[model samples]
Target: MEKHPRVKLHFTLTRSSWLNVIERWTGQPERNTLYHGCFTSVKDLRETIKIFIDSHNTHSAKPFRWSQAADAILASVDPARTSMILNS
Candidate 1:
């Protein structure tokens, strides 16, 4: 905290490695796509990775089931508040 006071820390709860779903998915893509593709130079490899990531993100499903984090937060806040918040 002292070393990087400007940087915010995000800590996920234990037993919830699934919270890092993006990284897990990325590793598989690397092994299946990038790793198998031949690259003659570092620039070639970098460009290939950039293209793959852009294409992957374009075709991938939304990160969370909910459209927005705010919506999820409001929905989970209180069952009573759900009607008011969502309708508001």
Candidate 2:
């Protein structure tokens, strides 16, 4: 960390499900295509995930955006911190 001063650290809650959408989304691919499956090479794995991603995007993917910055978003739910949400 000292050697790489430009790199900063940010921590997240271990038990927050609402903020773990990436984990949830990634699990779908693993369970749908990778689980109990065999891949002979890296190319096969990439192609499989690519196909799954393309199909999912075409049929099921929804648009997403971050309405707030990281600090504002995290502060909203953090008990130790206060944001506009807490005051309201």
Candidate 3:
């Protein structure tokens, strides 16, 4: 770190990956079907959830795209830079 002072570090808590997946997957169904929904019995709740999932699955889900274009990042660096962004 001392040798390359311009670099920065970010830290993530252990097991954070599951938390991200759980949040993304549950948000839509929870918002539309489960949140504040009234069901008369256990069977009613399960049936509603099953229907919601089946309906949701009919629509195609898009793949996550990772476009790691570095142009914008490099542009943000100061013009008075000395060292190359990547060391040889």
Candidate 4:
């Protein structure tokens, strides 16, 4: 890590690849959307990626929303740690 002092390193927790939520979200598009489409040119590929990412961001950008279950989960905290937040 010292060899690349300027670059940031982020280590995912061992034994839980699925715990990486971004990986889970990316995997959904890779399997169901990206891999199925054939792009004719770089411009086409870029446009496709932009459209998909924009669609994802529209729904996934917020932390708490009335219609999304993921937002509800994000809004929740462990009950055991709730008291710590109050005390702090």
Best by lDDT: 2
lDDT over C-alpha atoms for residue 33 of model 4: 72
For each candidate, the alpha-carbon lDDT, in order, equals 0.69, 0.80, 0.69, 0.68
Query: lDDT per residue, candidate 4, 1-88, as tens digits?
Result: 6467596544433455446766887787778677989989999988888888898789776663456577665566344346555534
- The residue-by-residue lDDT of candidate 1 on 7-53, one tens digit each, is 65443344555557857877965886787798899999889888777
TM-score of each: 0.47, 0.56, 0.45, 0.45
Looking at candidate 3, the ten consecutive residues that score lowest on lDDT are 79-88
Count of clashes in candidate 1:
0
lDDT of 1: 0.69
lDDT of 3 by residue, 1-88 (tens): 8467787654334446758876887787788889989989999999988888788777745566645557864564434233333422
For candidate 4, the TM-score is 0.45
Model 2, 3-75: lDDT tens per residue? 5868755554566766678888899989999997799999999999999999999999998787899999777
Native-referenced Cα lDDT, model 2: 0.80
Tell me the lDDT of model 2 at 21: 83
Clashes of 2: 0
Best by TM-score: 2
Model 1 reaches what TM-score against the true structure? 0.47
Question: In candidate 3, which residue pairs get closer than 3 Å at backbone N, Cα or C atoms, i.e. clash?
Answer: none
As for model 2, its CA RMSD to the true structure in angstroms is 9.1
The deviation in Å at residue 50 for candidate 2 is 0.3
